[model samples]
Target chain A: MTADLFLQILVSGLLIGLIYALVAVGLTLIFGVMDIVNFAHGEFLMLGMYASFWGFALFGIDPILSMPVTAALLFGVGVLVYQVIIRRIINAPMLSQIFATFGLMILFRGLAQFFWKPDHRLVTHTLVGGNVTLGSIQFGLPQLTAAVGAVGVTAGLWYFLHRTRLGTALEATAIDREAATLMGINGQSMFALAWGIGAACAGIGGALIATFFPIFPEVGSNFILIAFVVVVLGGFGSIVGAFWAGIIVGVIEVVGGFVVGPEYKTAIVLSLLLLVLLVRPKGLMGKA
Target chain B: MTTIHLPKTVGALALLGFALLLPLVIQDPARQNFLILILMGAQLGVAWNIIGGYAGQVSLGHAVFYGIGAYTSTMLSLKLGLSPWLGMLAGGVVASAFSVAMGWPCFRLKGHYFAMATIAVAEIVQVLVTNSETLEGAVGLSLPMGNTGVAAMVFSTSKLPYYYIILGLLVVTVLASWAIERSHIGYYFRAIKDEPEAARALGVSLTRYKLVAIAVSSFFTAMGGSFYAQKEMFIDPGSVLATGVSIKIALIAILGGVGTLLGPVLGAGILITIEEYSRVLFGSTGSGTDMIIYALMIILVAVYSPAGVMGLLHELRRRIPSLRAKAEVRA
Candidate 1:
C-alpha cells in the first residue's frame, strides 16, 4: 500500500478503536468492581443503537443529538439487570455467575428479536452524512464524530474516577470490597453504580456508531467477542489499559484484514489473544 | 450401605431393561429421533462433566472438540473411504490429542480468563474451518447415501439401529464416568476442584490432572460429534462447531447435576423434550418464543438451583423420610 493509503487505513482503524475502547471500558469496569463479566454487555450496545434509531425514526432527532438519551436509557437497564438477576448470584459459585450472564445474553437477544422482528435498521440521512478532508487525508464525518464522541465520554469517565469522591469510592470498592465496606462505602450500591456506568459507556458507543452501523438483534454478537479481546488485552478491569488496547486491537483487525483476507480478521485478533494469554496472562495493565 | 445400594442397583438395571425395549415398542420414526437426540445430549453432557464438573474447569469452547471429531470422521471417510466406525475412534483420538495441545497454554489461566480463551480458540477454529476450501468450506460435506448397513453405520430404512447405537454409546459414556467416579482419579479430581491449592501442596499436579480430565472429556465429546456426523450424513462448522452447541452440551450437564454419573442423562431427557416441543410449537414463525422460554428457564435454574435436578432430588429424598417419621410419631 502507498503511504497515503496506509495512513487512511490507520486513521480508520483508530476511529473504530475508540468505540471498541468505550464498549470494553464498561465491561472492564463491571469486572473490576464486582469481579463478574457481563456477557449481556453487548446487548446494551445493541439497545443503544436501537434507541438512537427509534429516536430518529419517531421524532426526527438525529442520532448524535439523542446519544445522551441512549446512554441514560442503558444506565437504567444496567441497574435493573443488576437488581433483578446479578444480585441473587453475587455470592453464588463461579459457574452459576457465568450461566446467569450467559442466559441474560440470550434473554436480551431473544427479547430484542421479539420486539424488533430481527430486521436490520439503519439510521440513514443523518446529520453527519458527509466526509471531511484534511490536507492529505480524508474520512467520513460520521466516523470522525463517533471517534470524537468516544474520546469525550472516555475522558469524562477517567476524570470522574480520579477527581471525584464518589468515583474514588467506586475505585476503592474495586480495589478491595471488604476494606471499602469498612470505610463506609456500601458495596452493593457501588456495584450497582459500576454497572450503570459500564452499561452507559457501551450505550454511548452504540449511539456513536448508530449513524453508520446497522441496528439488529444479533448485532451485539459481532462486537461482544471483539470487546472481550480488548478487555483481555487491556488487562481486566483497567480503563487506561482498555483504551490503548482497544486502539491496538482495532488497528490490528483492520490492517490485518487488509493484508490477509477479510474472513481471517477475527482469527487474527483471536490469535493475538492466545499469544497474550500465553505470555502475559494479567494483561497490559492488570495488577499482579 | 449395602442395603441402600442393593435396591438402587436393581432399580438402575430395571430402568436399563425398560430403555432397551422401548425402541421396539415406540414405532414412530420422529419419536425415535427424539430419543436419539436425548441420548446424544446425555453423552455429550457426561463427557463434559469430567473436565467442567469434576476438574472445575469451565471450558465454553467444547464445540472445538465436537467440530474436530465431526470433521475428522467426515474427512477420513470421504477421502480414503474408511468406515465411520473406525473414523469415530480416530476422531476421539485426534480430539484427545488436540485437547492436550490446546490445554497446555489454556490451563495456566483461571476462571473467566480461561473460559474466554477457550471461546477465542473455538472461534478461530470455526473461522479457519469456514474458510478452508479443502474441508469443503461453508458448503459443508455430505456422506454418500448409496451404501447403508450396520457396517457403514448408516440405516436408511429405520431409526432403530441408530437408536440402539446411541443407547450403547450413552451406556459406555456412563460406564466410563462411573469407573472414573469410583476410582482414586475421581478423588483427585474432586480435590483439584474443591481445593486447588491444597491439591497442589499435597503433590497432586494440577496441570497433569486437569489435562487428564480434558483428554477424557474431549475424547467422548468427539465420539458424540462423529456419531452426529454419521447420523446426519452431513457435517458443517455451523452445526457442529457453533458456540451454541458447546453451550448446550454444558447446559445439559449443569441442569442435570454436574459430577454425578446419571445427572446428565436426566438433564438430557428434560432439556431435549423442552427443546423439541418448543421447536415444534414456535419454529415456523421464527418469533424467538422458544429462545425466550429457553433463556428464562436457564436463568431461573442458574439462579435458584445451581446444583441442578439431581440436587433437587437429593433434597427431596432427605426431606421425605423426615416428614414420614414425624407423621408416624404423631400417629
Candidate 2:
C-alpha cells in the first residue's frame, strides 16, 4: 500500500481503538473491583447510543452536547442493576453469576427491541458531520472528536483512581476486599461506584460513536466480542493494559481485514485473543 | 457402581415406553414436529450437561461443534453423495477433534474466563465458515432432492421417523449420562467440579478428564447438529452456528438441573414447549417476548435455585413427610 493509504488506515485504526478502549475500560474496571464480568455491558453501550440518538432526533440537541446526559443516565442504570439484581448474587456460584449476567443481557436486549423496535437508526446532521483534510490525509470529524473524548475520559479516570482518596479506597477494595472492609471502607458503596463509573465509560463511548455508527439494540453484540477480546488481551483487570491492547486489536482488525479479507476481520481479532490467552493468561500488563 | 435403584429405573423405563409410543399415537404432523423439537432439545441438553454440568465448565460457544457437525454432514452428502448416517459419525469425529483443540487451551481458565474463551472460539468458527467458499459462505448449503429412504436419513412425508430417531438419540445420551454418573469417572468429575485444586492434589489429571468430558459432549452435540441438518434439508452458519443456539443449549441443561441424569430431559421438555407455544401465540411480531420470558426464567432460576428443576423436586421431597418416608423406603 502507498504511504498515504497506510497512514490513513493507521489513523483510522487508532481512532476506532480509542473507542474500543473506552468501552473495555468499563468492563475491566467492573471485573477488577467485583470480579464479575458484565455480559450486559454491551447493552449499556446500546442504551447510550439510543440516548444520544433520541437527544439528537427528538430535542434537536447534538450528540456531543448530550454526552454527559447519556453518561449520567447510564451511570444510574449501572447502579440500579447492581442494587436490584447483582447485589443478591454477589457470593453466588460461578455458574449462577454467569447466567445472571447473561440473563440481564437478554433482558436488556429484549427490552430495547420491545420498546424501540428492531430497525436500525442513525443520527443525521450532527454537529460533527464533516471530514477534515490535513495535508495529504483526510479523516472524519466525528471520529477525531470521539478519539479525543476517549483520551480525555481515560485520563480523568486514571487521575481519579491514582490521585483521589475515594479512588484509592476503591482500588484497595479491589486489591483486598476483607482488608478494605477491615479498614472501614464500605465495600458495597465501592462496588456501586465501580458499576457507575464502568457504565459511564461505556455510555460516553456509545454517545461519541453515535455520531458516526448505526444505532440498534443488537449493536452491542457487534462490539461486545471485540470489547471482551480487548479486556482479555489487555490483561483481565488492567486499565492501561486494556488501553494499549485495544489499539493493538483495532490495528490488527483493520490491517488484517485489508490484507486478508474483511469477512475474517473478527476472526483475526479473536485469534489474537486466543493466542494471548494461551501464551500469557495474565495479559501484557496484568499482575500475575 | 452400575447398580440402579429399582423405583427410579422402573420409572425411567415407563417414561421411555411412553415416549416410544408417542409418535404412533399423535397423528398430527404439527404435534409430531413439536415432539421432535422437544427430543432434539433434550439430546442437545444432555450432551451439554456432560461437560457444562458434570465437569463445571460453562461453555458458551458449543455451537461450534453443532455447526461443525452440520457443516461436515451437509458437505459430505452434497459433495460425495454420502449417506447422512455415516456423515453424522464423521461430523461427531470432526467435532470431537475440534473440542480437544479448544478444551486443552481453554480448560486452564476458570469460570467466566473459560466462558469468554469459548465465545471467542465460536465466533472464530462462525467467521471462518461464513468466509469459506466451499461451505457456500453465508448462502449456506441445501441437500439435493433424492429418493426418501432410511439409509439417506431423509423422509419426505411423515414426521414419525424423525421423532423416533431423535427420541432414540435422547435415550442413548441419557443412558450414557446415567452410566457415567454411576461410574468411577463420575466421582472424578464431581471432584473436579467441587474443588479443582483438591482434585488435582488427589492425582486426578484435570486436563485429561475435562478433555474427555468435552470430547464426549461435543461429539453428541455434533451428532444432534447432523440430525438437525438432515431433518431441515438445509444448513447455514447463521442457523446452526449462532451464539443464540449455544446459549439455548446451556439454558436447557441449567434450567433442568445440571449434572442430574434426567434434568436436561425435563428441562428440554418444559423450555421447548414454552418456546414453541410462545412463537405460535405471538407470531413474528412478538419477536422479543419469548426471549424476555426466557431471560426472566433464567434469572429467577439462577438467583433462587441454581440447582434448577431437580433442586425444586428435591426440596419438595424434603418438605413432605410422606414423600420423605417413601423416598427412604426406596433408598
Candidate 3:
C-alpha cells in the first residue's frame, strides 16, 4: 500500500475505533458496577441508531443535532431495562444473568424488527455532509465529527466519574458494593445511574455512526462482537482499558481487512480476542 | 447414586416407547415433522447438558460442533460419495477433536469468560466457513437428488425413517447421560462444577474431566447436526452454525432442567411445540412474534426457576405431601 493509502486506513481505523470505545465503555461500566455482562447492550446501540434515523426522517433533524435526544431516550431505556429485568436477576447465578440479558437482547431485536420492519434505513443528508481532504488524503466529514463526539463524550464521562460526587459514589459501588452501602451510597440508585450512563454512551455512539452507516435492527450484531473483544482485551469492567482496546481493535480490523480479506475481518478480531484472553485475561488496563 | 428411581425409570421407558411409535400413529407428514424437530431438540439439549449442565462450562458456541457435523457429513456425501451413516461417525470424531482443541485453552476460564471464548471460537468457525470456497462459502451445499435410500440416509418424502433416526439418537443420548449421572465420571464432573479447587485438591484432574465432558457433548451434538443435514437434504452455515442455534441448544437444556436426566427432553418438547405453533400462527408477517414469546419464556424461566420445569415439579412434589408419596410409590 502507498503511504497515503496506509495513512488513510489508519485514520479511518482510528475514527471507527473511537466509536467502538464509546460502545465498550458502556458495557465495561455496566459489568463493573453489577458484574452483569449486559448482553442487551448492543441492542441499545441499535436503538440509538434507529432513534437518530427516525429523528432525521420524521422531523428533518440532523443526527448530529439530535445526538443528545437519542442519548436521553436510550438512557431512559437503559434505566427501564435495569428496573424491570436486570434488578430481578441481580443476585441470581451467573447462568441466569447471562440468559436474562441474552433474552432481553432477543426481545429488543424482535421488537425493533416488529415495529420498524427489517429494511435497512440510512440518513443520507446530514449537517456534516461533505468530505474533507488534506495532504492527498480524503475523509468523510461525518466520520470526523463522530470521532470528535466520541472523544468529547468519553472526556465528559471521565470528568463525571472523577470530578463529581455522584460519579464517585457510582465508582465506589462498582468497586465494593457492600462497602459503598456502608458508606451511605444508595446501591440501587447507583446501579440505575450506571445503566443510564452506559446506555447513553452507546446511544451517542450509535447516533453518531447513524450519520454514515446503515441503520437496521440487527446492525448491533455487527459491532457487538468487536465491542466484546475490545472489552475483554482492554479488561472487563475497565472503561479506560475498553477505550484503548476499542481503538486497537478498530485499527487491527481495518488494517487486517486491507491486508487479509474483508470477509475475514471479524475472524481476525475474534482471533485477537482469543489470543488476548489466553495471554492476559484481565486486559491491558484492568486491575489485577 | 447408581440406583435408579423405579418410577421415573418406568415412566421414561414408557415415554420412549410412545415416542418410537409416534410416527406410525400420526400419519400426517406435518405432525411427523414436528415430532422430528422435537426429537432433534431433545437430542441437542441432552448433548449440551453433558458439558454445560453437568460440568458447568456453559458454552455458547456449541453450534460450532453442530456445524462441523453438518458440514463434514454433507461434504463427505457430496465429494467422496460416502454414506451419511459413516459420515455421521466421521463428523462426530471431527467435532470431538475440535472440542479438545477449543476446551484446552478455554477450560482455563471460569463461567462467563469460558462462555465468551466459546462464542468467539464459534464466530471464527463461522467466518472461516463463510469465506471458504471449498465449502461453497455462503451459498451452502445441497444433497444430490437421485439418492433417496436408507443407505444414503436420504429419503424422498416418508419422514418416518427420519423420525425413528432422530428418536433413536435421542434415546442413545439420554441413556448415555443417565449412565454418566450414575457413574464415577459423573461424580467427577459434578465435583469440578461445584468446587473446582476442592476437586483439584482431591486429585480430580479438572482439565481431563472437563475435556471428556465437552468431547462427549460435542460428539453427540455433531451427530445431531449430521442427522439434521440428511433430514433437511440441505446444509448451510446460517442454518446449522448460527449463534442462535447455539443458544437454542443451551436454552432447551436450561428450560427443561439443567443437569437432570429428562429435563432436556421435556424442555425440547415444550419449546419445539411453541416454536412450530408460533411459526404457523404468525406466518411471514409474524416474523418476530415467535422470537418474542421464546425470549419472554427464557427470561421467565431464568428469573423464576433456574432449575427449569423439572425443578418446578420437584419443588411442587416436595411441598405437597400426597404428591410426594405418589411419586415415591411410583419409584
Candidate 4:
C-alpha cells in the first residue's frame, strides 16, 4: 500500500476510534460505578441520533448546534431508566441482571420502532459537509469534527472525574460502595449520576456519528457490539483503558479489513477479544 | 433428594401420556410445528441449564454449539451421503469437543466476562462461517429431497415423525438432567455455583466440572440443532448462529427456573406459544408490536419473578397448607 493510502486509512480509523472511545467511556463508567452492564446502552446512542435527526429534519436546526440538547435529553433518559428499572436490580442475581438489561435492550428497540417507524434517518446537510485535503491525504470534514468533538468531550469527562469534588465522591463510591455510604456519600445518587453522565456520553457520541452515519432504530446494534469489544479490550470499568482500547480496535478493524477482507473485520476484532481473554482475562488495565 | 413424591410422579406420567397422544388427536400442521418448536426450545434450554443453571456459568453464546451441530449434520449428509441419525450423533460429539475447547480458556473468567467472551467467540464463528466458501458461506446448505423416511430423517409428508423425534429427544434430555441432579456431579456443580471458593477449598476442580457441564450441555444442544436442520431441511448461519438464538435458548431456561428439571419445558411451552401467536397476530404490520410484547414479558418476568415460573409454583404450594391451617383455626 502507498504511504498516502496507509495514512488515509490510519486517519479514518482514528476518527471512528475516537467515537468508539466516547461510547465505551459511558459504558465503562456505568459498569465501574454500578457493576451492571447496560444492554440498553446502544439505545441511548440511537436516541441521541434521533434527537439530532428530529432537530434537523423538523426544525432545520443543525445537529452540531443541537448537541448539548441531545446530551441533556439523553442524560434525563439515563436517569429515568436507572430510577425505574436498574434500581430494583441492584442486588438481584447476575442472571436476573443480565435479563433485565437484555429485556431493556429489546424494549427500547421496540419502542424506537413503534415511535420512529423503523426507517433510517440522516442529517444530510450539516455545517461540516465537505472534505479536507492535506499532504496527499483526504479526510471527511464531518468525521474530523466528530473526532475532535469526541476528544473534547472525553477530556471534559476526565476533568470532571479527576478534578471535581462530586466526581471524587462518585469515584470513591465506585471503589467501595459501603465505605462511601459510611462516609455519607449517597450511593444511590452516585449511581443515578453515573447513569446520567454515561448516557450523556453516548448521546454526544451519537450526535457526532449522526453527522456522517445513517440514523435508524437498529443502528445502535452495529455500534454496541463494537463498543463491547472495546470495553472488554480496554478492561471493563477503566476510563483510560477504554480510551486507548477504542483507538486500537478501530485501527485494527479498518486496517485489518483493508488487509484481509471487510467481511472478516468483526472476526478479527473479536479474535483479539478472545486472545485478550485467554492471555489476560483482566484486560490491559483492569484491576487484578 | 432421590425420594420421588407420588403426586409429582403421577403428574409427570400424565403429562407424558398427554404429550404422546396429543399429536395423534391433532392433525393441524401449524399446531404440530408449534409443538415441535416448544420441544426444540426446551431441549436447548435443558442443555444450557447444565452449565448455566447448574454450574452457574452464564454462556450467552451457546448458539455456536447449536450451529456447529447443524452444520456438522448437514455437511455429513450433503457431502458424504450419511444418514442424519448418524450425523446427529456425530454432531453431538463434534459440538462436545468444540465446547471443551471453548470452555478451557473461557472458564477462567467469571460472571459477565465469561458470558461476553462466549458471545465474542460465537460471533467470530458466525462471521467465519458466513464468509466460508466450503461451508457454502452465506448461501447455506439444503438436505436432498429425493429420499424420505425414518432413515433419512426428513419427513415431508407429515410432522408426526419430527414431533416424536423431538419429544423423544426432550425426554432423554430431561432424564439425563434428572440423573445428573441426583448424582454427585450435580452436587459439585451446585457447590461451584453457590460457593465457588469453598468448593475450591474442599478440593473440587471448578474448571474440570465446568468443562464437564459444558460438554454435556453442548452435546445435547447440538442434537437439538441437528433436529432443526433435519426438520427444516436447511442450514444457515443467520438461522442457526445468531446471538438472538443463543439468548432465546438461555431465556427459556431462565423463564422456567434454571436449576429445576422440568422448568425449561414449562418455559418453552409458554415462551414459544406467546412468540408464535404474537407473530401471527402482529408480525405482518412490521410495527414490532410482537417484539414489544415479548420484551415486556421478559422484563416483567425478570423483574418480578427472578426465581421463574417453577419458583412461583413452589411458593404457591408452600402457601396452600398454611392457608388451610388458618381455615381450620377459624372453624
User: What are the runs in model 3 whose C-alpha is more than 4 Å off?
Assistant: B2-4, B322-331
Candidate achieving the largest DockQ: 1
For every prediction, compared with the true complex, DockQ reads 0.80, 0.70, 0.76, 0.78
* Residue B199 lDDT (model 1): 90
TM-score of each: 0.98, 0.97, 0.97, 0.98
Q: Can you list the residue pairs that collide in candidate 4?
A: none
Query: Could you tell me the fnat of model 4?
Result: 0.67
Off by over 4 Å in 2: B322-331
lDDT (C-alpha) at residue B149 in model 1: 93
Query: Candidate 3 on A30-112: residue-level lDDT in tens?
Result: 99888899888899999999999999999999988998899899999999999988889998989999999999998988898
User: RMSDs, each prediction?
Assistant: 1.5, 2.6, 2.6, 1.3
In Å, candidate 3's interface RMSD is 1.0
Off by over 4 Å in 4: B1-6
Which prediction has more favorable lDDT, 2 or 3?
Answer: 3
lDDT of each: 0.91, 0.91, 0.91, 0.91
Question: Once superposed on the true structure, which residue ranges of model 1 sit more than 4 Å away at CA?
Answer: B1-4, B329-331
- Of 2 and 4, which scores higher on lDDT? 4
Ranking by lDDT: 3, 4, 1, 2
Candidate order by decreasing DockQ: 1, 4, 3, 2
Residue pairs with backbone atoms closer than 3 Å in model 2 (clashes): none
